[model samples]
Target chain A: MRSDAVLNEAVRGPSGPRKHRMLPSWVATTALLLPTYAWLTLAVLLPLLTMFVFSFMSATPMGKAPITFTLKHYRAFIDQPYLLNIGWTSLVIGFWTTLLCAIFGFLAAVALARATVGRMRETLLILILLPFWTNGLVRVFSWTMVLRENGFLDNVLHMVSADTGSISFLYTRYAIVLGLVHGYLPYMILTCYIALVTIDDAIIEAAASLGARWWTILFRILIPMAAPGLISGAVLTFVPVIGSFMEPRILGGKVGVTMGTVIEDQFTQAFNWPLGAALSFTLLAVVLAIFATFSGVLRRGAAA
Target chain B: MNNITRRNTLQLMSAGLIAGAGYSMFPRKAAAAGTITVLNWQGYGTDEAWSIKAFQESTGIEVVHDYYSSEAEMLTKLRTNPGAYDLVVLNAARCAQAMAEDLIAPIDYSKVPNISSVAENLRANENFNKDGKGYAVPWVWGLTALAMREGLPKADSYAVLGDPAYKNRVALQDDAVGVIAAAALLTGQDMNNPKDLDLVKETLKGFKPNVKLLWSTEDQWNKSFAAKEFDVAMYWSGGSVRSKRVSKLPVDFVVPKEGGIGWVDGLGIPASAPNAEGAHAFANWMIDPKFYVEWATKAGAPASSNVAAMEALPADDLSRQIHKPEYIATMSIMSALPDDRREAFNNLWQEVKAFYAE
Candidate 1:
């Protein structure tokens, strides 16, 4: 009976005999959070949901045509039979670009962390990251000026030998990979540098005191410790390079068909939005699978 | 005190986010009194010629301009944001598609009497009108012709594009339908619809080895061509002519013996136009002989749609090159493709692009 009196007092306020009660703390917290979460729901989540719905549609939602749901958009790869080839081409580009960036970036990070000190290291870091500040489309277009036939590269060669044939390497797979590596190398370097900088110098000194050579110290201690950073950088680079269309279009030219370009065609040229949405979901699935496969390393890196 | 500060900060952040989202959801527009908004390509305004400014001064309608790079981009904008634009410049082939989608409204010819002043060949062309009603006015036209570097043998046939001698020295337009249509022209088949997919595929494959680069943007075209990246390309008429005149290169534009594709850009009013009357006024003003003359002279393309306007311009090299009525007659005009045919051609083009080098 006393507990019932207390419940009545809590519901109707401590001093008043009225029946209205104050809202619970949890409800107040939710109310405070609603506007922010609602913004997110309206901006990002709603568009994703709309795209997911459109993927199952028969055509773009234009004109007075009847709307139907079908899986034919998803099955486009099977029907055309050549989309598989494009997918494989994209995979190949991603593999090469990632491998090159990993090798180049890890070395640059090592040099910055160990070799340089004070203002020298800071300047070098700025130099490495300078490209990231410029616009990517402009950077990609400029490479054409440097790599096209009778361009900067060929002119340099001409100075060395008067009768040399033009060593034009633009519009090839090599040029595409070169442009992509230039664009993404800074990302890998920044990631690996964060991991490398935290390594205690004492650990390296102790290994050297124990009769370990530079190669031994690097292979055994440095690499294994920076594995998480390397893995995360690779994941970031690989994901974007696989879905890249502009770099391949500018540099790879006629041989530049990839899943990204195909999806772009659906939206821009063919006016096939349903097929584009389905292909995007397929790409998203691939991205998710890659992250799931590497979540452990990412978690470790974050913790570090 | 700490708890109160934290709660205040959270509330402020939430308020800021809500405000931002609301602002983005309904973007603020300038006051709309006497404003005539036009959606068009980049070069058609007073920036390219003085006539547009002259028109605005005469009409007292404030001109607001928005630009798009491609027809598809224009279509998407029209679909998403209705009633925001008064006029849109679209390809002649897209008139039917726009009508069927109810994206544009029928034009009143009585208001735009300048329509009668255009050359009879271009006025009320089937592509711009339907069942005696007009929806679009022909503005500019050009051809996709063969372009080769100076001192090369004259390329009179479409077969020259596929020749192995120019291997690794050829560029094609990075367009799906245009590429396949050109290939169809090479085989002497129906340029609009090729019944035999396999035959077209085989024909395109033969040309693939020689085509080392495929360019899409005008910048890419200019930079690469200036650098001597390729010996020959499927070049746009106006750009190729400018390249020859400016750089004095042996850049030659030729109408291949097989045929070439002709494209016409036209101005139309959207169905949901807020200022349809102003749009008609602008359309009428655009096709006026004096304005056409100024546009053709400044923009460096012929005003074939307005015969009186073409005659007004001096008989110069650029005018003579683009104003050839006989050449225009030989050109195969583009038309809206049926859905089934469009799909088939798109698929075939994808196959050609994805072809792996052996």
Candidate 2:
């Protein structure tokens, strides 16, 4: 009878008499979460709130300019039609980069999952992640050595065919795509690898036994199983590629003016913080819209 | 303005820190004195180890430095951190803005004796002198001009940048103001406030066939040149000097017949300076002939504004040869541009770049 009473007390928390004496569960939870919430408020939310305010200002609140609120900055796209073209260019670049990463990354992850195992898989995983160790600027700069005229690619080509003309494509969109792919490919691989590793080996074996061809098993089974990873990787790659300036600036050369560079110019060169903030908010809005459109798929993927 | 690239600035900051730590081991009499902080571009003359060491030993005033990568950043630092900086380096084009904001104090010329030797025209330039009060001491000046490979024929005009013969072999600096100014010069208009911006845009767009690279940094320009990326580029006079003297790149700098876009940097005392006396002493030393010669010979530098400092250079210095005093008369010195005009220039340049991409 005494043990039963103890079990009852454990299930119902403290006995009724002592209930008021103990701290509330919500209070304890709030205490636990307070640090993280406080940190987020200070670091992320506060700056974002400040930028949001600045975006509506007539100009940067510097010097002796009398500050006034305005929506002219948000009307930038309507005022300057060229921004639409630049926005489209950024999207196109993002699309290509994401598609390329998905294809290459999915294949690499499949190879790691099926073709390799044990120590070999571990070593390959490390090798795949080695690029992250080097600086992004260094990686972008190294591409010039490989892609420029009379560079490594040209030198190797000349060795193969003495009369071969220069095939250097540095300062081109292709070069920008290549550098970006090199920089962000690891993200796609790691995410896909996580999704692919959890699939049962029996599923593939059963498909094979049921007269499924290699392509059939691959497309019908493997891809569906890896959809979550593919979506996640595409999101990761596309978001950053659209906002990237360094790759375009270094590799695309004269063709490098994107929304990213324009926004950068407003803050650093033009000293127009309001315009930059407005552009940034517009970009953020587009990003949010994308997430909203894909929310259903993302939710299903997360649940799976 | 001598704006170092962000990458170079970080490297310079670390290098400065290491040097600063090394200097502390051999503390001089100034070690115990009050510290006076200077605001400037990292690796600029103010933070040079040898000069800082010498200045400290002689004056018995500890000098520390803070750095900014861009003129905008420099202004932000001055505005946000009152009394944190005793001295700051301001571009002549920006001196008016700083003065209007009261970020800088009126420089007492009597305290800076070296001002007497500075070029009369630069000293009296309305950019630094506003309402008959000097705000900045003219420190160094340079111009943006054509830098061509050694074997190429000398380019006497900015039109060479668009010449069809040099198709896909021309590089342009990636600064909106500098590029627009060059185009304005080509179109026979005032560079600072061009009345015919559309004409200037057309002129810039015409160079699309020739522009292979739009280089932003000295390092990038050098590497691209070394890689045989382009034959000619719109490069800085100081950059050309360093390319030839330090990196040993085979390049020739020319002002062209239309003249280059000129810019002057000045040293100014901030309005909230705690060590105004120390700042004056440092400014005097900065423009001193002895210091200029050492800095020029050992380290590549922009042309000094001080006439005596320029004359004190060895007969064959690259900077002296490139930055001729007569060029100052022909060149259009950049002045304080209104915020709207600056934005317009940036937008025009962006539109022109998009056109080039097409």
Candidate 3:
């Protein structure tokens, strides 16, 4: 409270160091944060609680079936060994998608922050974000037109050389990862750009004046400064990528069954809501664990 | 004059944001009265077919169309939100389940005299009728058949889907019932209750090498087919006809020699419908021979039950494609599955999908 008053004095000018004339600090803080906390409670916390309760049920309480509490839903992975494999597939997709997005997005952010300026940089940022405006399903479907056999990519390859064989990569894991990266690249870029743009150019110039090479300045200054953006972007990408079934279903085809798709089947096709809820909680645990592990770096980055 | 300070830019942005939010916050008008909402499948709505516009113009009741992708989705929506929808188009297998759950009310035949134009065989079908009581009125019926590019070898058998020659060139339906039934039919087992679970598993496993994709929604399959992603697929009978006709593609749909899975999608009123009168009127108007003729001709769905509609169809290539005898004879209709067996099939499908052929 003392620090906040000092900060307020700094902002309001020292000439009129006005006496604290507001409500108690705690009351003011609660009043300011009430709406946000209420929104989170209603939207996120309530649904999560409902899902946890449903996870313990024997059957969906719909139709003629009587609902009973059971642990069998949690034992789904053990009951069906294939779920383990699907979980592993989801992990693999999450890993590759995050890695690729970080690399591509960080480089794009660097170029936008350092190499471009003004209108050009603004236009490029808009272009990067344009995909997010369109429906994700439609964008994923469009990838099929480019990657399928005799598709646009194949035709382009053939045009370069008549003897080129089919280069169709659709219905493959590689295509799934590619589509995911395309879908999430803008987010990573945006976060990284925000971090990078705030970086002081004088710091790099000072390093160069001290006989530091381009690589040294980049490794020592740019990357460390941008770490927060990269980490946050990766967390955002990895969490959703693990929960995505549509991209894998459309692009990966027969090979696309992952933990996300399995959970979806339980609710939509199998009508096994309890099992789906259990699987969802398991995924949530994994996501929370990831965030927990990175909490330190995230806190430091956020402060930066 | 052009020195725009950070504070000035922030003020401008805030002003723009306020205008945008204020515009959206304005109160919108309520829905007009006498409006009846119908929830149906994607392509079945009047916006796609345009024939249903005639009914709306003739009757004063306004028709609002919504769409549900699957039977489970339809059931969930109807169960959770009573009185939300006046009419719904549900599959035969689901119609029986819906009636038992009291999600839908039994049809009052007196209110819909167009039932007379529908064939007796269709009205008495097990899906919509229980103890001589009709629930949903059957509208469109089709077989899940094999659709291959015209020049490809005639895929008259399900075995062709697993043939090494067509490896990485075939797509199957992604649903548990459709894939399991197809596997059962191929193995010469009863589709509804196959005694040989191991053989069914083996049949689906054997198909892994040939299967390139498993498409779930009609939109998924149609887009993939239009892009020529696969040479052959387990095609939705009505969807295949529509796509082939629209694209002028030389794709032929034939009932596989192993027989085909069949389904009948029709209209029914929700038990808690707010506008039951409007719902019945809309249902009867849609099934009338006069409107069904246009639906059959324009929608590219077979009007098997509407006798007059069938006769009115042009005796042309399009009509022949729409109406096929084998769609009925070899058709294995889907029935409600016992819970344990349903779970078994779902698990088996997951295993089959995860299977990798060496």
Which candidate comes out best when scored by DockQ?
2
Task: Give the Cα error of residue B99 in candidate 1, in Å.
Answer: 7.1
Per-residue accuracy of model 1 over A1-304 as CA lDDT, tens digit each: 9999989878986666353587887998999999999999999999999999999988788764678999988898789888877887788889999999999999999999999999999999998788789999899988888887778898899999969898878777888899999999998998899899989999999999999999999899888888778888998899989888888888888877888888888887787888889988988887788678878867885564
Give candidate 1's root-mean-square deviation (CA, Å): 13.4
Superposed Cα deviation of residue B146, candidate 3 (Å): 1.1
In model 2, residue pairs whose N, Cα or C atoms come closer than 3 Å (at least 3 residues apart or on different chains), thus clashing, are none
lDDT of 3 by residue, A118-143 (tens): 99999988888887899998899889
Better of 2 and 3 by lDDT: 2
Instruction: State the DockQ, from 0 to 1, for candidate 2.
Output: 0.45
Clashing pairs in 1: none
lDDT score of residue B222 within candidate 3: 71
Report backbone clashes per prediction. 0, 0, 1
For B1-358, candidate 1 gives per-residue lDDT tens digits of 1112222332333333322221111122333248778887655432232444455556666777887765667888888999999999887778767877889988887878877756555555677777787788777666777888878997888788789889878888877677777888888887777767788889888887788777776556767777777888887776665566665556777777776777776789999999998888887777776766655544444335655566676776564554455555566767788766777877788788888322
Per-residue alpha-carbon lDDT of candidate 2 for residues B1-358, written as tens digits (9 for 90 to 100): 2355432633544463433432333234433356789998777778777777877877787789998867778898999999999989888888888898899999998989999988877877788877899999999988899999998999889999999989999999888999999999998999999999999999999999999999888888999998888998999887888788768999999889898898888999999999998899889989999888877765556799998999899888888988888777678889878878988998898888888876
Residue A216 alpha-carbon offset, candidate 1, angstroms:
1.4
> Docking category for candidate 2?
acceptable
**Chain B, candidate 1: TM-score:** 0.73
lDDT of 2 by residue, A84-165 (tens): 8888888888888888999999999999988999999999999889878999999998898999999999999999998989
